[model samples]
Target: MTTTADPPQPDDAGAPETDPPAPPAGAEDPATSFTRQRATRWLEPHLLLRMSLRAVVSAILGEYNDKRELMGEIEADGFLDLSTPDGDLWIDYVADLGDGFAATYAVATLLSRPELEVAPQGGTTHSTRQGRLLVLGGDECYPAAHVDEYENRLVGPYRAALPRKDPDAPCLQAVPGNHDWYDGLTAFMRTFCQGRWIGGWRSRQARSYFATKLSAGWWLWGVDIQFDTYLDEAQLSYFRRIAEELRPGDAVLLCTGKPSWVAATDDDVEAYATLDFFEREVIHPRHARVRLALTGDRHHYSRYGASDGAQKITAGGGGAFLSATHHLPETIHVPPPRSRARSKSRSTTYQRCDVYPEAGDSRRLSRGILRLPFATPTFAALLGGVYALLTLAVGAALRDPAHGLVEDVHAMAAALRGADVGRLAGGLADSVAAFLLCAVVIGGAVAFTRDASRRRGRITGLVHGLLHLTLLIVVIRGATWLTAGMPGTWSLALVVPLVFAVGGILAAELVALYLLVVDRLFGINSNELFAGQAIPDRRNFLRLRLQPDGTLTVYPIGVRRVPRDWDLRPGWVPGDRERFAPVDGIVAPFLIEEPIPIPRTAPGTAA
Candidate 1:
């Protein structure tokens, strides 16, 4: 287990290395250990209300999907040229974006922060600011990538949060994530491909991918990969034109919606292979090298590299649930340095931030649990065990011994003591039937809670049912053995059966609780089949500056030691759209900037 600490800096920049023999993989990164100190909160009853009005609007826009001709021809007029007034290109990159209002609202606040805002603010010593190009990594909205969802979840919140750029309006561009393709890129194109007004910003790109020209031999090459399933002859041809435009020794900054080959646990090959294909098929053919590659998905800050000094970063912290910093495969993980709070917002309870997920819910639940530091299962199981014991003691006193049910229990005691196995079955019928009650309790708990805008609830009734049966068996055998001393009739029915039944239920809950806690530490399974890592609760972004001669300096900004901006008003409609402000309060206090040095290589146009 690697504890979260200051990230390492290469002593001197050199060529990126080939995949080296990795250290043994282990669970629990530093962030996981730090989160253990989190305090318990009696959560306010969460009551999520359906936004019928938003639904009505979405229904109206559904017809637009058929009008591809009107949204305009699939534009691939590749690349936009903006002047480098200061000889530096600044772009703010965020991905896994488009949660509800609060989520986008928070990011907009970062964009609108006084420090980032163009106008000079008083009392600020440093004059560093935000980017001219706003690039989205992917996954623009949640549930399913419908047009209506984009309006309320993405366009509306961002519009309300950021003031529009004009004349020299900062350019906005995006590549779709898996969720965006859920609708076959229908909504994604309309919102982003149109290159007009979207959430008060102007889209400048013509296609899902772009080859932008930056100054001094630096270029930005972003591609769609189209879910890694849609790349075609036309896409390859588009890059061929880009390659023709490039000079020898020119370096490229690559952007994709997904991160692959960065971790040992990453089993997906589409994106990873797409990258390889691009490098061999397009980049190498042009004699250009990918200097830096950035991606979203896996919502945290992580960096890895190849044998040629090239680097890849996973900076999906835009506004999704924080991923488990602890669970990152030990292979290429980089921890960030701890920071002192300049000023912070009043701490609020931890709130789940993931609304748009690329995979199944069971995986979502597992990942969400992993992001939290607390070993909730141990404590939760303790509580369940106490409740089990108490339920037995209290339930016994409430029952009248003369009742037939109670009397049968008394007979059950006699058989149990006498080893009268045949008689015991008949006496225990009611108690055995009552075991279903344990399943019922577990099923109900699983059904009631959920996250917003995700494709499905993390926990489900059926999932709990299976879990109940498995845990019940353990309880039954354990309870049977523990109560070996049923010496009398009174002990078997009134005392023993009650204790055994309640104890068994509570014991089952304890086991379930353990699964929930461990899921965060070592995210394995989900409530749903085919789940992936538990989603994390971090909100971060990357700032990259392309140096004149192709060397790139990267500053990865992290939000805080522990997130406290989890306060959201009731209702799916974030009515407080006007209230979204800089995260955790104060200017630039929460962001930790760790500069990575890129090796300066000889500059020339490759033949």
Candidate 2:
């Protein structure tokens, strides 16, 4: 009986006699479940409110000129490198016109390399040793029709990097961007047209929109997309006539500022849809050798194809401010389709494509080789990180030994002692002055940090601003210390407090700005105001709502009126009643109880 009882007593190594009860379905442990639900409920509305406020602030402050000084400095330094391995082929320049206005310009002789060869589909590659290079795109600067501006911004760069044009090279052909129409293509036609001279007459110059054939068998058709609208009746007729005249082996290279089906505004998209008209009426009917379209307004490179085998290539980043980031569509149609393989930075690099004839196959497609400097966001982030780390390390290493870290502390104390003091009262006054100076330095730093975090649009901007503000405070404090003439040596105690005070002031200012401008004006309700998480959409309209049950609902406002064409839509409206689960997982009504006021003050107004 004793042995049996001992055996029945549970042994440490044996399995438990009974298993713990399983958690109920859709339920978690009390501590963990409560924490998760709390987090989700708190974060959802807060983020939305914060983003709405940021957008409103950006819209209001966008017109301010707070960075005029910075702009001037950038302009003076010419903030870009325009050199190539071959030599300086382009002069990139930025001009500050004062009051926050600036213009960027670049010039380069973009000549096709004669020695380069292009291989056609189904044919052996052949070299074009000395063929004339044609200017496939820009021949003149637009909008700023002033001869001086054009000469400085456009002609100068090309002349500086002027490639030796082969005497027997083909005459350059050209297309015009939106800017060309600002002056009605007058200057462009005067510079490039070889036929009837248009002279100073605007109407005659505008006639440059007319089409002309560059070679006998190969037709270079120029189409003027006015405001990125569809081709006019005359242009369409001209294209049709040219299509009819094209022989079986002849190729038509179409030039325009805007590609036929690339992303653009509704009006522009509608206009380019007319390319379909061309494809059905002319391209497919003729079944020509090669139908190539080239454009440059995007300021980036891309290749697309129409269903009828029409190839479209965008070579817009020709020494201009690079286009915004682009994403390739899922269903792009090209003869030999290519997809975007990598992400890239906003760059000013230019691309050069070399085309050559293949030896064996006459029915082969043309080969294109693109040359441009590659860039990536990762590279930029790495460079910025290195710079920041180096700065911090250098600053830390350069501290004064007497003060434990700060070199100027002792000198500052000494300066305070040397101040002219006729009596005990005067000496006290000098001491007080020294203390106030320290306070100012501290206050400035706090203000800077607070402002910086609130204005966190770009990481680089935040880092640069914080570093600069801190340095300013440091220099000011050091100068004040030197002038005061006191007797005490530098001490870590004093230095630490001073640095802390400065940082605190900066942070406070930023917080204050966020609360006053961002939160109040933009209706940002975060955990600070309402105990919940926040969600924000930077590109949409503002929206925020506090719920009856203590939770807040925040999102973009004005949904019904949001154009169907818009890529994104804000979630809320004034009268509509709907419920939405915010990013933080809090569910609340979509519409807010009250309307938020939009400030008329421009962006950077506070700055």
Candidate 3:
């Protein structure tokens, strides 16, 4: 494979002085429009609650009544042909981006630079030029895809990174993740599929899904699985037409929103089944090989490679919260050895290789869950309210009609001073409504457990609920003893406030502990544990180069920590490249692991 030299361009040269024609109204704004801001706080109680509700709505209504079906009607075909003057190609692959301004801008600034000096592991440092084509695998915006959010979190930072139009500007294409679909892909289509310019990079795709002919004998297929729903007739038909152009021995790079291969290993087979069917029925028949697959829903970097040299990589670490990599399976059989899904594709074993942040760092970071009370005070406050409600319920359920607050407190204390705690619990069970409420609390905890359909998942949830329930009992009894000694109604005023403030912290801490325990013991709640942490470190992205001889070299670049401060560059324009520069100096990105080289030829096939 022969590499071509792309001479670096000077900062002041190559870019046009004026902006690309004004974007459509409500479209993405250029970088200079907004100031850089902090990353999203995923664990904020309000955000978590809102996102949970949005997810439920999306699952029930969004997936079934897909927006993609309607998009097919407006767009003629989902294809972007970029195959031109035969030569080497450089491409940038990033996913799970568009969170905080600093993290997103950091990656974008690096991408915008003419070339980077990357330090590959155990090898001499080398310089690699920026990609001419930028592929956003999925989840372009965090939380939800809305017009304003696109401008703030995503568009503004990216435009700032590469502000002006340059002669060698890259082209941008994207696939929607579940987050983007939360808004029914309205903002996503406006941002990427409208054939507008995103910063200096051109948006050429006309539909949510696109088949890009990168060059002769090489193709890049960006498919929209839309919440892992089956490929609609329109999407299937579009790809089928693209397949018609494939010649024998052609190579393909698949870009999808989710990592179906990883999902299949966890017994969620629907996504993997659909992907497999597409390969067997639509691609394999044409004798075109899917040499590589990329996805970004996980917010981490992981590669699963088969003996045949096909790689399925998850590199979602563009700018979102850092996801844990410790729980990834060491090996998985694609489609599972024994599944009911119909498929002719042979079962291939993919072994996990090169996980970023290393498993140890992931575990160390999980400890951050313990800081939940301070990090997410909103969630902590909610927990406090729940505790207060439980306390009121217990007091009401045990209240004697003839007794007042002070009298009732003293009476209950005296009556239960020597009585067994079980007897008190049994008395609460006497109130069917009260018991049901308690049961609901337990069930709610269990519901948060992943794979709730499985016994282990249910048990983990039960344990989580029981811990909270036990805390409630202790707080109630402890307050009874302490306040029984205090005189009058004053105790009531003091206790009520404490229940909301102090109790909240206790409940939140209990949840954090539960998450840490379950993640280590059962490999559950890893996402929740880290989402609570909202870590902004360990960011990464992939830069790929396709040589003239048809071989691909992947540089997995990473930043150990993102810079938090930035200074405005001198004489920067609204759409110029150097709008914001890191005040502490640019943090160099290093290769997380050794570079992976994949020849157009497979291990057992002839070139």
* Best candidate, lDDT: 3
**Number of the top TM-score candidate:** 3
Residue pairs with backbone atoms closer than 3 Å in model 3 (clashes): 39-100, 163-575, 163-576, 163-577
Ranking by lDDT: 3, 1, 2
lDDT of 2 by residue, 436-538 (tens): 4334434533432322235442332344344534443443344335434433453333433444444334333333333333333333311122111111110
Runs of candidate 2 exceeding 4 Å displacement: 1-133, 136-139, 163-169, 194-207, 210-218, 248-250, 264-271, 282-290, 305-310, 333-607
lDDT by residue for model 3 (242-309), tens: 78888878889999999999988865755588888889889989888888999999988999988878
Candidate 1: stretches off by over 4 Å: 1-75, 83-86, 114-127, 263-265, 268-271, 306-308, 330-467, 472-523, 526-537, 561-593, 599-607
| Clash count per candidate | 26, 54, 4
TM-score of each: 0.58, 0.35, 0.90
lDDT of each: 0.50, 0.31, 0.77
lDDT of 1 by residue, 1-607 (tens): 1111111112122212222222222221211111111211111111011223334444444334322223223433345764365557667788876664444556665764434322112322323356767788887776447777776667765655543434455677787776676666667766775545544356765556666777667777777765454355556676777788777777777888776554323333232445666776787666777777788866666676544456777777665544544334444321111112232222111111122221243244453333222433343443344434433332333333556775755544433343333332222223533344554555554543232312333444345444544444344344445555754344543444444445544654444454464344334322211111223334567666666655677656554432335433234232223233334643232333345555434333232
- The segments of candidate 3 whose C-alpha lies over 4 angstroms from its true place after superposition are 1-32, 35-38, 84-86, 403-433, 480-484, 570-576, 583-586
